[model samples]
Structures are given as structure tokens and as C-alpha cells.
Target chain A: MKKTIDTSGQACPKPVLMTKDALVENIDELVVVVDNPAAKENVSRFATKQGHTIKNIKDVGTKFEITILKGGNKEETEISAEEFNCAVLPSKGKTIFLSKNKVGEGDDELGQNLMKAFIYSLIEVKNTPSTIVFMNSAVRLCVEGAEALPNLQKLAESGVEMLVCGTCLNFFGIAEKLRVGNVSNMYDIATLLTSENTLTI
Target chain B: MEIVITFKLTHNAMKAKRKVLFDKLSAEIIPTPREISKECGFSLLFHDSTSEDVRDYLDTNELKFSKIYLRAVVEGERKYEENN
Candidate 1:
């Protein structure tokens, strides 16, 4: 008979812990339910490493149902389980907006320089925001040869989402030259800024 | 270990920045929100240690710009400096 463990609605470690408990009591199959992608990944990794065979992984957006078979020899290790402990860090989300080529109004030259410095500083920001939106002439800053390109690219590699306005690119006629980030529209812009505590440039 | 630097004028700072490089240099021109009480707009920000280098670079390039002023984090913790 197959045993099931419902970990939906539970936080990280709890889902992991419940899965572990089910594994100890189950013989053939253990079904684990968890909400959030991170929790699902962690739980699946942990289960597969514990000599349990992951038969299938079904994603249900906010939750997942994973079916794991018992006593399978797997190459993965036990650290996946340890990742669920109290020391397991929580994820942080961050978002920034670059409105203009420069930071403020006054000295146009200084404003541009300040913009570069601002982007550079975010590279070191702990618990960084998830995305950065660039608009107006600021969109040009992410194109090839822009001064801030290096920093913007680095942040993108680190899982930070880079969004540039499509209309802005069309306005500047440099849409094809964008070096990094995704092109988004007005609805996305509104949702992104309104959904989070955004910092505007 | 970033050094702190301040400018006497905003235009000078941007001029200093342009002569240096839009990139490469760790410094950036920010708004002089602190220096002037009047609503000007922005200023410049750079590494404190690089202030002398920035000054020398501007002088060598003979770039003319605006005045610089003082600014600090009067509110929340800022990553570098904000151009008010």
C-alpha cells in the first residue's frame, strides 16, 4: 500500500520533516505534497537522496505532488535533507527602477555618473530585490557598451530579473541592441512595481 | 574598503565623471541634495578613497562643470548615495 504525506500550507522545514517521517513508515510509495517551488525542490531532492526513487514530480503551481518509491540506490546525498533545517535561509526579494539616464535632475553629467554608482552598489546589496526595471533613457544603459552593463549583467546572472520597457527601446530605436534582461510591456510594469516595494530611479 | 569622496559642485562632478569614463571608475555623479537648499536636482557620488584621483582626473582633462556640496544619509541606509 502507498502512504501519503500532505505538507501543503506548511513551511519549508515542516514539509521536509513530514516527508521524512512518512518515509520511515512507508514501504513502497510515499506521496509528498508541498506548496511553493522552493519547498518542492528541496523535498524532492531530500527524498531522492534518501534511497527513495522519485517516480514522478507533478507541479501544481502553488503546490506539488511528488511520488517517491522506496529503497532505491541513488547517487545524490543527504545534504538535501539538511537544507531544511533551521539554519536554512529564507529567500529575499528585491526590485529597483532606473527611470532616467541620470539619477536626479540638476547637473546632467553628475546624474549620469550617480546612476552608474547606484547600479554598482546594488551588486553588494544583501538580500537583493528580485527585479530591476529600466525605462526612458535608462533603457539605453543596459544596451551594449553602456557603462552600467557589467553590473546589470552580473545581477541578472545572480537570479535578479532584468526588465526593460519595450516602448522605450522602440522610442530609442535600440531594441535589437539590448544586451541583457527581458522586454516587458505596460501591464507587466504596473504589476511589477505595484506588487512589490519598488525603488524608483 | 571603498574610500569616500565629495565634490564642491554637481556639474564639476559629472564633468569629472565624463572625463574619467561612464564606466570603469567606481565613482558616479549624484545630486547635491545636501549642498544646496534650493531645489536643483542631483549631485555626484564616488569612492571616498578615489576623491583625489577624481580631482586630478578632472584637472588633467580640463573639464568645467557645476559646484559640489555635502550630503549624508539623513534617512534610511543607502547603498551608495542618492541624488536627491
Candidate 2:
């Protein structure tokens, strides 16, 4: 017996919940359709953990179809259910605070290089911070002449919010050159830093 | 439509990046593609059509680089091919 479930346009936990409900029907084969990348990945991971072999995954334009074959023992199902209970970890709210254009104190050139390297490395990682707040000299990074502008633009494109200090930009006389992120005030910056899991650099 | 420029060292990559920005050329510093081997952790990426301008700038400025590649997205994966 084959069954199909459409989870398009649903958010996190919704797709997982619907998929779990479908799995209880004891269907021999299940086909799940999800529109978002996160939904597709979550559903696939959940199904694989439930001991269902993924027969194939087909991408049709903006959506995906995942075909899973059920064949694991009853014990595996119990373990999978237990795992599911602990699987949905809450999203960590991460914020990076940049107070300087350079990363470290010694050797201005080396510090600048390290700063560039750090931003490049940050974007390559799977889990990027939710926001990056730039203050002081770090505001130069979002300006026209900054070497890190390209990387900053890429980060913005990847859904990482950039918050550049407006006071810093005005102090530096580059208010018009400010690029990539929105200009923010001290009050908003403080609110974000205090309310979230922030790391200062 | 992107090109990757790998450097022999982090400093050299930073130097080339400064020069590129100084010249008002469009480029970005990105993590070196897995396909390219470099001593530096970062690489310079720009539009593929800017190959001539980049080549001239690098050569004239005597910047040290390991290789230059044209990046193409094939079947949802980024593939890099050596340009020169």
C-alpha cells in the first residue's frame, strides 16, 4: 500500500507532526512533498531515523518529493519514537558583536587579516549567527572602501542580519557610503545584545 | 558566473583584495572552494567576465596566487575549473 502526504507551505514541527501521524498508518511506502528546504531536510532526517529507507528524492522546481520504504523491526520504531521526542531542539538565538575592524590587539595588519578570515570562515559554516552587530571601527567594514564588504554582502544574502552603528558611521564621515546592512542606534544594539545569546569580538 | 582566485598565503590574499577594492573592481572574499587547494583559508571571487581586468591587475601588481578558476553551478553543486 502506498500513501502520499503534502506538507507544502507548512512551518517547522508542523511537517514533522504531520509526517509522524502518517507513519502511524502502517503504510508500506510513503511519499512526502515539502516546499521548503528546511522542511524537506527535516522530514528526510526524521524518516531515516524511523528506519525507513529513502528510496529516492526528486526535486521538482520549488518543491521536493521524498519516497520512503518501511521495513524496520518494531523495536526500531520504538527507538525512533523516543529519538523524535528529543530531536526537535529549539533554535539557538545567536548574535555576533564586532567592536573593532581588526580581530585582535597586536599587529594591525595581522589583526585585519584575521578579521577578514574570520568572516569568511563564519559564512562557510552550516549554522550561521542570526545577526552580526558592528560598532566603532567595525562600521568601516560595511562602507564602500572596506575589504570585507563582499563577504558581508554574501552573509546578508544568506539571511544573516547586519546591524551597523549609525553613530560610528557618522563619526567616521562615511554615512553615505554605508552599505550591506541597516544603520542602527545604541538603544537597538543594546536591546539585541542583552536579549539574545551574544558573542563579542 | 563567478571566478575564484586562490592565494599562496593569507596576507597575499588580503593584499590582492585591498588592491581590487582600491581599483574599484567588483570582488568578494569568500572561503576557498573545496575544489581548490591553497595555503590561505580565503579566496577572492568575482564575476567571470572580469577575468581580463583581474588578470591585468594581479599581474601588474605582482600579486602571488596559486590559481584562478571559473566557478559554475552544475546540478546544484558548485564546480570550479582552472582558468589559467
Candidate 3:
């Protein structure tokens, strides 16, 4: 006997579970329909691992029709639905928080040089941060004649948002020396710090 | 093409930077690329056109350095070849 289950529009694990339930009903042949590619792969893997034969997969418009044959193979291995993994991973915008002019502790001069290299390397990374918040002594990095000015300018030109603290710039007495980023207040900085996927340096 | 001059010590690297800038040659201090040396040290990066100017200035000022590399972008990545 043949049975068809329309799992279209349903999210992951749901389609896998529904397919498993259909197979459990002792159906000889089952056709499972899913909307997304991930769902299709998950269901196909689940059914194949259960020692069933995959007869044919048809792409009908935006959905896929996967025909699975039960008892087609002599060696049938029963597997749990949990064996199939859903491929959806949450993607968040990354942010870099610079609170100091240097990168780490130890030698102050080395730290300063390291900071220059660190900022320079940022332009070379594959996944650049969506935002860079500069505070405290780190504000010097965005100022005129700063070693890191060119790199920061390149990042800004490439659409990376640079938020330089106004208070820090004022405190440093170089507010007019700002060269590459916006003069942001504490409220905006605090919001980004609390909400985004921030990496503090 | 660009040139990167690495130093045995950070002080020499800093001194080289001051010497190059005092002469008004275009250069910046960058971390030595791992392809050159795995050690955590500094290097001076300048344009290929200024290679002679930088070499002369550093030599005249007695700024000691370890190696000079010819930095080129190959397949969208920086590859350093030892110039001397």
C-alpha cells in the first residue's frame, strides 16, 4: 500500500517526526513532501538511516516529494528521529568593543603596538564586525595622525559603523582631532554593549 | 608591491619607525606576519617605490632590522618573499 504525507510549510523536526509516524503505521511505501531543503535533507537522512530504500525524489515547484520504500532492503535498522539534525543556527551581528588604546596587559609600548596590529588585522578578517565601539583611550585610534586611522577609515568606508565616545574624546582634549567615526553618547554605546554580540577588548 | 622590514627587537622597530617618519617616508608599524616569523614582533610596511629611500634612511640612522620582505597579494592573500 502507498501513503503520502504533506509536510509542506512545517518546520524542521516536525517533518521528520511526521514522516517517522507515517512509517510506523506499517505503510509499505511512503511519500513525504517538504518545503525547504534542510527539511528535505533531514527527512531523507532519517528515512534512509531506518534501513529503508529511497525510491525517488521529485522536485515539484518549490516543494520536494520524497518517495521512500519500506522493507525494500533486507537489513532494516530502526533509528530514532532525533538522529537527524536540523541545520538552523542563529546568526547574530558581531560587534567589537574597544575600551582601551592597547590590546592586553604587560608592556605598555608592546600593548600599543599590538593595538595597531590588531586594528590593521581587522581589515583582513573574512567576517568583519558590523559595529566597532571605541571608548576611553581607544578613541585615539580614530583621531588624526593615529597609527590606526587608515585602517579605521577603510573599515568605515566598507560600511562598518564606528561609534567613538564623545566624552572620551572631550576628556582627551582632542575632540576636534576626531577623524574617522561618529561622536556617540553613552546611551548609544550602552545600548550596543547590552544588546549586540559584543567582544570586549 | 609593498615591503615589510622585520626587527630582532621591538626597540629597533620603534627606532626604525621614528627614523623613517622623521625623514617623511611613508611607513607604518605592523605586526610581523606569521608567514615571515611566528614570533610576536613588529615590522615596518612601506611601498615598493620607497624601498631604496627606506633602506638608505635606516642604514644611515643605524636602525637594525632582521629581514626585508617583498609583500605581494597572491590569490587575494598577502604572500611575503624575503627580499634580503
Interface RMSD values for the candidates, listed in order? 4.1, 2.6, 1.1
Q: Order the candidates by TM-score, highest first.
A: 3, 2, 1
lDDT (Cα) of model 1: 0.70
Question: If scored against the real structure, what TM-score would every candidate get?
Answer: 0.50, 0.61, 0.74
Model 3 TM-score, 2 decimals: 0.74
Best by DockQ: 3
lDDT (tens digit, per residue) of candidate 2 on B1-84: 687888878788888887876777777666676678644477888865556667777899998887878888999977988887
Better of 2 and 3 by TM-score: 3
**DockQ of each two-chain model:** 0.16, 0.31, 0.68
Model 3 agreement with the true structure over B1-84: per-residue lDDT tens digits? 698999998999988877776776778888888899998888999965455666777788888988888889899988988865
lDDT of 2 by residue, A1-201 (tens): 899999997766677778777877878988999887777777888887777788999998999998888764444232333433434556874899999999889889768877887887787788899999999999989998677887889999988999999999999999999878999999999999999999999
State which candidate, 1 or 3, has the greater lDDT.
3
Query: Least accurate stretch of 10 residues (summed lDDT) in model 3 chain A?
Result: A72-81
Could you tell me the lDDT of residue A110 within candidate 3?
A: 72
| DockQ-superior candidate, 2 or 3 | 3
| Cα lDDT, all candidates | 0.70, 0.82, 0.86
